[model samples]
Target: MANRPKKLPKALQKLSKPRVDHIPGLVIAAPASNSGKTVVTLGILRALANGDIAIAAAKAGPDYIDPAFQHAASRRRCINLDPWAMTQDAIRDLARWHIGASAGALPDGQSDGQSDGRFVLCEGVMGLFDGAAGGGGSSADLAAMMDWPVVLVVDVRGQAASAAAIIQGFANFRPDVRIAGVILNRVGSPRHRDMIMEACARAVPDIPIIGAVMRSNDLALPERHLGLVQAGEHPELEVFLERAGAIMARDIDLDALLGLVRTQGTDHGRVAGTNGNDGTNDTDGDHGRDHLPEAGSQVQDQAVAPKDDGAAVSRYVERFAQNNANYAAPVTIAPLGQHIAVARDDAFAFCYPHLIAGWQAAGAKISLFSPLANEAPPQGCDAVYLPGGYPELHGAVLAAADCFLDGLRDAARRNLPVYGECGGYMVLGDCLVDGDGISHKMAGLLPLETSFHQRRLHLGYRLVDIRQQCPLGNVGAVLRGHEFHYASTIRADGEGWLNARTADNRDLGPCGLQKGSVFGSFFHLIC
Candidate 1:
């Protein structure tokens, strides 16, 4: 017997009229950083979700923070789509997975573009055209890959009519990329809004004025050195999202914006894009150098080994365009153990959702605990993962957590895999000096000392080869990830774990450290 289709609730049915059997979506972009695109993206996501519309969100590039806020706004898991670090197929697969996961499994013949009335909203990173130093991984690349129209969020604070020139230039910049609309942010007054709108209409009449957002303090989110404060730490987050949504609902053209979204044709309209060039002149046309480890070394493989077939380390080489190879194809790194304990709190909140999702997909169970709340990792867990976050801000409190510190040491003694990244890595050290120059005792599992007082920015995409066997991977296993931290290593004494180089081939030498079953680095794995 054929089963009948389940009907939506009355509220959802009322909101589902305009969706024409397609999972409509658009990329919210900006001319430059701090152009109010993040706020606009959050506002739109919350507004649509509030209207009983199913929403899925993603962020272009390797950003762990923005996706957290996007997830909070849309009430669904948000994934990072990094054109620099991830292949086009992986990006599309992630998008499809996110949509299907959010809106329940798609019907037998349905495609990503034909969802159950769910809308996918992607927030662009940095400037629309800005990418890695060598090129590729820009917001423009993601938009072109997805065949979605871009809605530019122009910050109109310092300029009025001149804003149209920027819009016109971008509209004609790339013949392959489409500019569908504009959202005027930080409009001074009615006269200022009128002037910008009139200029845009006269200059780039094809690009519609999607919205004119007035200047307001309500939409701004607090920030720390790394990025915006974690969504979990925001006390009035609900109120802030509601107010932002209300403002977007009042000012933005919700219906017109939806109209600009592209409906996919089974292949998700992927054929139109996928040239794999992210607008950079790099040799790979993807991003920085992809260094496969040196060949002819073998070691015992563990749960944390690369999930794909075992391959000897191949020497680092520049990929030319002859074969048009995608060196950044996503690699699934196996989980550390069957049951992994992850620390989660305001101080330890920089974990990536996709990494966790990948772990679960590989048949691993994740148990979360809070060090800031004086909680320890769950008992009987085989491994512990401490993610990067603002541990420097709460150094005193973390130092006071006796249970958390003791449990971490106990894990180290038990030879359980205990891994950390950046902030997490700092906590596993002997001592951490805060921004105020005060030293706090930390878990003495590793012979490392770091200081926030003498901060130095260490930020970029990293191509790393495992230097020694650790829980992360076997020796000579190559991996791709990112590193962004302000803490400086004050003192260290241990064997190097990873031999890393920046995306552009700048040698970073050996990084992080390893001792017994404990190992970590400043870099956060992306794949």
Candidate 2:
């Protein structure tokens, strides 16, 4: 008999209301990566939020942090719309749900219904035209699909006329995508702004100039090894956003900007599935294609597959879709009857907020457990979760923490679900390789060994096929997730237990390994 079909989550089943017609909005796009699009977009969101404007935020790609900042600026939860990660149906549903006209008084300071119309602010990823490796999945693709106007955010630090050429190329490169206006970011002075604005007017006369933000070293966000510091870690993030918004309000043309944006029409239906029809059902039939592998397929099947860089790009696109769809109908896990201690100190703080919410929704009580200050998992907790974070930075302190190590050993002995990711995965190994080619003794829960000395950036979205039964779910089940880590573990002297691979079939060795009650891997589960 064939395997049973997986049921769609409750969140995905409900049909959303139709979108409101003529809803004003604009998406902020840039010429390339690191163009300061996020800063400018967030500043606008904050400034508008201070008024009577009922603004909604949407991200054009699969980013976790920027959306958090958008959420802060808009005083609402931001939604993601990625052309690659999700089906068109999901994106339409999200747009319809949030794209309604405002009726009540402003939550900020403006009188109710002053800026009564609804507006969405979408922040673009990377470059506007730079799609994924496959060349089709991009922020521009999303703009064309939604028919939303695009506001170009240009960083005019070095060149003036050259910047105009880049903007003109983007405006003309895609005839369908409308470049509604421009936001000059990081301008040096009034003269620099004037030069850029004049050049842009001459080159792309159709696209209006909205704002020009001057250069400011104060706007720079803190960064770590991976990217911008996670928003959760930065408590002063609100203040930073307010400062950026004030600067933008002082420098940019706020009212002229509002005039340039064209409201989008209502009509939230999806462009039928790949079959090219107009319906909500998935034509591909198979859902969670990114997660589970076909049954009876060995790891060797993936070993010989052609290297399609497009697969990586598609995974990135799919992330946006998945995020939006999941939000429409959030997965509610079984409740935690007993308290589950989670490690959440600076050394182990890389857990996704959704995962914790999932656990709590499922009825599991959450109690934060700190190992950094020599604190152990709380007594009577049923399970312990050690998420990925900067364990390498505090290797010596962790190596010397007897209480934390012993507590983990006790939990393992008691047969509790002890799950870990990237940094946490390293802690569960027999030994961890430090920066100076030295190995530090860890919990030794798993038979794996990891090294941080020889670093490599292994980053991408993933689909995990459950080869064996563990705590997360049943055997043969698939899980949506992502992998980003610098350490490489060598199986020094134990049986390998976990197996993983990228969406395009590259080797991702020993991701979800389990030994008794302890299970760990470098992969971060998003669902």
Candidate 3:
């Protein structure tokens, strides 16, 4: 028998039309990691959004910070489209979901007069062509995947006409990826912008000059041990976004600029009913031959299954029914799962909000534990999560906290799942040698020792292939994550337990180790 019919809300049914057109969008790309891309993108989005345009925002790769800024600028829920971490279908679905949510509205809710025109603004990653180690899955790759036009955000500093040459190379380097326009960022003055404009006009006349943002030291956001401070922590973030929007609106020629972008077609028809068929068969079939049930009924039937593809479809239908669900539901852990205690303090706070949200949404109760307070795992905590942070800074305090150390050791002995990131990875080691060559005691759960004295900057987004069964998942399973730390950890006895490797096939030594239930890794998983 076919799966039961999923009931959707009346409001959602009324607004069920596809929101995104075949028209390709725009991706604001850069040459490197910090090239004022976020500020420029935010300015563009805010300026356009202020004009009553229905806007959908997306992050090009596995980033949590830029999306937050995008959300604030566009006044919409920004979605992350990581080619490595998420499937192609997931990327398209995310775009369509945001487009749909932004285009339609309830009878009683806020409605901007004309709702037909929906535009998507995708913010690119580190560099335009840089991707995971093997050289695939770059921002350019994502732009090609979505058939989006590229709006390069070039930081116009230290070079004048050389910037134009760089832009020219990027434009001609990849024939398939479209470079629509350029937004000159960090331009020194009006004369600086004029020089940049003239250079670009001479070197790459085909690429239009959209906007030029002046250099402003005051606009810089503060950085923490991690990347930029989390958007939530920035109280004046909205104010900054507004000021940025005003600046762009005043300076940029929004209408003429947007007109330069060519709309490319997408194949959305391929994705319509391919969500594992949760009984949304709009096809002609024999009604008497198959016993079909209601939408919620089908969901109830699959409620007991460990991983139900149909459940995701049913959940989608339910969200459509509610008419309040915004972004597409991400693939998550099973609901009614065991509880996990996650360490979340200033010293160890690199957990992804979505991962935690996904886990909680999947029915895993996340209990927040603090190592800085020397807090023990709460009663009945089934698992422990120790994310990356500046544990090295609090080495003395952590060593002094015998209770927290003893609790971690006890948890390890009890066979509870204990996952750790860079800083957390050090915590599980026998000892940590600080920058001054002073060693401090740790939990000694793993046969490893880390040294901050001899610092080596290991930074990149990694594609991890699971080599053994552990709390995360099965062997040979690939996961998208990132690694950024200044410490070097080597096996004390030259024995190692590394799992994944870089895109170049070079082993990223012992990303994850599993001894009984004790698991630790320097890689921070995004999905």
Candidate 4:
């Protein structure tokens, strides 16, 4: 971290400076999944931003999707703070840096100058107490480590006064983790809200009711198999956010909630053990992966391809550009090459921001291309990285993307370092079967075939020991990552790449394959 650049690139200058000693922040968590925490988090972020409060958003664990929506709501880059995959120092460093980069001297790093007055709003993954099978990485873990208060978003759809039991359980779950407040979501009626409010007063009177969100089908975001069909794919996303913000601002006590934020503390960072796991296999399933960069005109020229709907493509490109503008200040990791072409777009969008920013910090130039747009890896890139995304949904489109497929094959022929993960890995294989049971020809760089139709949930935290020299690192270099995808391998050939295991130290034997310079697996790296 000492080698990290003192100044961020010109592109990142837009983030307002943060208060070094006191940037107010809180962790917005819930009792369980579908408690409407994402909606509530987005609403609060948008509402606060609307009221002229500069906001910084973060997601707990290794999720890459929700942060994109969080960024959209806050009009800022949203970073993932993973308790499981990163060290305690790494977690605190990332959080401090993200609160505002210009704030001076963090515990582990230094930034120059004044405060931007940004309030960080971090959304929790799944349930608050949920973490990996070994028990470490959870929203509660993050809240405790940061010494910040948690605002529980409890879904009160079916029960009213009984919601007090759920609130009391979470409040007393961990002594170190404080449940400062609660937001009752999906309230049925005035009576419903009042009943829950009265019960909480008699039970957990120390904890206050932050808000009671009225039930509304309109507030719900659309979802497909993976989760909410990505914030990027949503039509009228801005309208949705605007409406949600207005509702939250009207219903919630923003000032009271703000009071719960730990505004003035430098010693809040307390050390915990480095090893953590994202709670449960289903935790990753709910949160999704790959928060994309803010889209901007910089990508339009090279990233967007010719589609049948020209006007639609233009709008999509413009929206995509909004999220692609800034890259985070780098945290160090070894660069694969001097220049790397990374795949992005709806098809291959699971690349981590830290990985990209780290590459840039390590002095590697990154060029992005869209396989969904029929684009190839940019010329002159010494290496290519294909990240995980929803390739199965667009199998036919990718099969028809001749330029993209041909360019990938050409890169492999040149013996360039080419790596893929999950969806990207599926594309590099000989063939892929979509959910409709239609098999399409792929890049054919690896002697493998996969099927999204014949799905099987292959998930959980992975401790990969690379058995061969590849893009990640030297042989025997251990990496902590995770595998969360439904694409089953139909056929696989070639030598094994990684000797992997679960978080609890169970052997998974050989994972993924390597042939020449091209290799991939379903594993997604996180650090």
Candidate 5:
């Protein structure tokens, strides 16, 4: 990042500043995945979003889909706060910028804007303590780091007394992990729920039973590979949200759950969210208050609510004027491209919505074309972005896409900026092997080959030190992203240029292959 600007990137100028906030949030976790974490979390988000209790939602670990559902539930742009992929500073900065900051100042110096630091509800990824490397990047790890309480969701389907054992194990397993409350999921009957609650009280009297969700097949969301289908792809997401919210609001005790998140961290003059945890902690000098920002002000305004249906919603930062209307609004300093061509389809669907929206807000035009549908990039596009997706399943069809491949080849020969991520990274190589061990020729942009036959998961947070200038950033640019792929490299194009390190600062050595204007890796850029 030698050519990087001395000043902070305009994107983070508003945020990245150190401002003290009485930030109090909770992390919803489970013992293992498929424990109804997503449904319960969404239910809570919807139940609390009555326009009175100011709430902000975030997702722990490196996931793109859950955050979308979170956003749909809360009507806010859900931030991805991966403890593994991001530093402590970055995680806190994002939370503060999106959930803690407000547009105007208050008499008590508290926020008077959208984010008044009232309540931050975060959904955990996978199991509570599951991480890419040990438990460093897990949801429990994030809670411990942020000084937040953990609400463990146990799927008590067929067990009654054993549920208390599960609760006790999670609560007492780690001292650093503070299991403040428990939410029982998939209860067969009211009697069943009572039995579990009784068992829980007898086992761990200190741990509170916040709620018990009744089992209902109708409440389940449609799912496929890559987790629950993206919120945008679901036509009845809004209906599902309404139903989930109704169930939670009807079944759960809102006041009791709010009481559980009394004070995970120090309540330094907190005047936003009420501390009604029944005197659980020393909140002597604390008085919860709500302050709204003054009119016609601007500080943090990135989240946009979706329209009527559960259709796709895009989030991007908007420009603001300094004082008067005579001057032009402040603009972003850097952009991905003037006119960008993007490979967008079911085959390539993991692009972050915020990135594209931010680019457009910076005077960049995006032209999306589908390669799976035998379409090439739109004309006059300067840069092409191929996001990660399930390319291995469609290897044969993609290989026979002569029109798409030929066009990409021409674009690569012209030295147009081209970047691939994960599956896109695989398709840019010479050949890709499908699940059946069938070899298929790809764009041949880079001299590399990969196979999914001998699958091995390479998943974690990566800190990248750019070795050369690329469209993403300048040489020496320090970028934080994640790498989660199953493809094993058969031939790695020999010479690599990825300068990366794991979350714990272990050197990953050369990882990516960059050939001319085409550069790719099995890494997915988050920020």
Candidate 6:
């Protein structure tokens, strides 16, 4: 007899993947940045999750940080769905993937819409219509592609009547973007709310005001260079989310909002509003540039290389037109050596949750160790992974980590697979110079030295080609990822494989270091 279906592991199964009548999905968008979308989105997600609702959160852009916060707030696995860099099919598949497993794997038409599911709560990036390349990659673009409704969050502070005008303009701005409803954020008082409600009735009479959030200091999230301070750093995160959820439940029309999302939806719904070409400058879309690199050109920093087979990098170019994200398992960059030792701590905490989750899903055992505490990788582990983070802030502690340093050097000598990125790459190097210009000795596994003292932002999307023998599969394997760091390479020795380019299609040259079995680069893989 055929084997019966075994239950998925609890860690994966614990995620709320409800079999539903329909996926009541909605995009929490704003008229502009800082219009209170993040807080509003979080509150909505937290409230729904607390009520035993199966909800999944997503961000509609190429950001790694905001999704972390969304995941934290919703207590669910959140994914990033980008329009510019990722194909429409990839976006659609990922959208469905974000919602739990459906009884049928086909599109809504192939099977009935009665599949079990989870609702997607997407946090829009920038403004609703802001796209760097034409209007091709905006949050509106994603909404249009998926035929999903957008719930606009408007800050009604300082002006009451003008808020209605903003809503009407947006509702009538683009025919392709559907403005399902509006949420008035930061209202002054009952009178202020009443005035805005009346104005909204006059301007966009049909659009419902699903929420009227009053101005309060409690809902704000702290910010920094990347974005909001990491969701993990928040001490009273649970308390904050609970309070925020209560606020949304008390103020926002959760029942009406859920009703709007539950309406029989189709991908071919009639779009709302329209747009005109008034001639404005926009960056040209990211073309492959058709430039190929010669083999054996080593790079100093981490970068991507072209695959020997050269799969057209621009295959996933169009939105609302393609049919596959070309899903691939993240190339196993760590040793298949029985056990995996991952460095996890404040000083080294940039590992992607998906990669680790994937490892566990594949039945791999994971062991975590802290380099900050001067602890070494536990015995019996065959592979070691050191992810990137703010090592500059904890330079003295890492420098004094003799056990970790010695154990790491011993691992390298023993030829165990070792890898690093940015800060981790710094740890695997000869030395790291902190922002104070003080030097500290590192593992000295790779012939490299990096410095935070000479910091400069090196931020951009990258396409990598694994051209040589390494943990990330054999030669000719290709990967799409990004590089963001303030540290710079101050010294390097032996050659490294991999060539890459910017989103603007500029050559980034060869990058990554490979000395014996130890290797790493600063690029963080997304696919």
Give TM-scores for every candidate, taking all chains together and pairing residue i with residue i: 0.80, 0.69, 0.70, 0.81, 0.70, 0.73
Tens digits of per-residue lDDT for model 4, 1-527: 01212222232212222234333467999999889999999998888777766556889987878887887887767778778787777766565556544322333222222222244578999899998888878999988887767889999988976899999988888988878778788888767777877787678766667577788877989887667777789989999999888778766656546534422232321111000111111111101011111111111111111122123222332222222223245564577788999998988877777678678867889999999899999999998899999998899999999999999999999999889888988899999999999999999999999998888998788889989988688889888888888888889986679988988889989979788899889889885
Give Cα-based local distance difference scores for all models: 0.72, 0.64, 0.65, 0.71, 0.68, 0.67
| Arranged by TM-score, best first | 4, 1, 6, 5, 3, 2
- Per-residue alpha-carbon lDDT of model 3 for 80-175, expressed as tens digits? 777766667766655555555533365433434322125467889888998887767689998888777787889889888989998999988887
Which lDDT value does model 2 have at 524? 75
- Sliding window of 10 residues with minimal summed lDDT for model 1: 312-321
Tell me the deviation in Å of residue 59 in model 4.
0.9
The clash count for each model shown is 2, 17, 9, 18, 7, 13
Candidate 5 lDDT tens digits, 1-527: 01212232222112121112334578889999999989988987877775345566888877877887887887666766777766676566555545533422343323333333345688998899888653378898898877777888899988999999988888878887888777778888877876776676578765656567778876898875567777877899988998887776655555545644443343310111223222232111111001111112221211111121111100101111001112221221245579989898867877765466457657889899988987877889888889898789889989999888887888898899888998888889999998899999999999999999978888778878888777777788777778877789999855666688886778988788899989988878866
- Residue 119, candidate 2: Cα error in Å is 6.7
**Candidate 3 Cα RMSD after full superposition onto the native fold (Å):** 15.0
Q: After TM-score superposition, what is the CA distance of residue 32 in candidate 2 from its true location, in Å?
A: 1.3
- Candidate 1 local lDDT, 195-259, one digit each (tens): 87778757875566757888998889999788898898789999999988888877775644554
Clash list (residue pairs), candidate 3: 5-293, 5-294, 5-295, 6-295, 7-295, 9-321, 24-264, 335-362, 498-510
Residue lDDT tens for model 6, 1-527: 12212232222122122223223467889999999998998888888777656565888876766877777777777777777666766566556544543313455312123222355678898899986532355899888777678989999899989999999999889987888768788988877877877787677755667677878889988875566777778888888888888887777756546534543143211221101011121101110001111112211211111111111111111111122222232323333456789998877877765466456545677899999999999888888888887788788899899999998988888999888877888899999998899999888899988898998898767777776688767777766667888888899886666777666567777788988878888886655
Ranking by lDDT: 1, 4, 5, 6, 3, 2
Q: For candidate 3, what is the TM-score?
A: 0.70
Tell me which of candidates 1 and 5 scores higher on lDDT: 1
Off by over 4 Å in 2: 1-18, 21-26, 45-122, 131-137, 141-149, 172-178, 230-242, 254-262, 266-329, 332-340, 358-364, 378-381, 401-403, 492-498, 507-510
TM-score of 2: 0.69
Candidate 5, superposed: residue stretches over 4 Å from native = 1-20, 46-55, 72-76, 100-119, 172-177, 219-226, 229-243, 258-342, 352-382, 394-407, 431-433, 436-441, 452-456, 462-480, 499-509
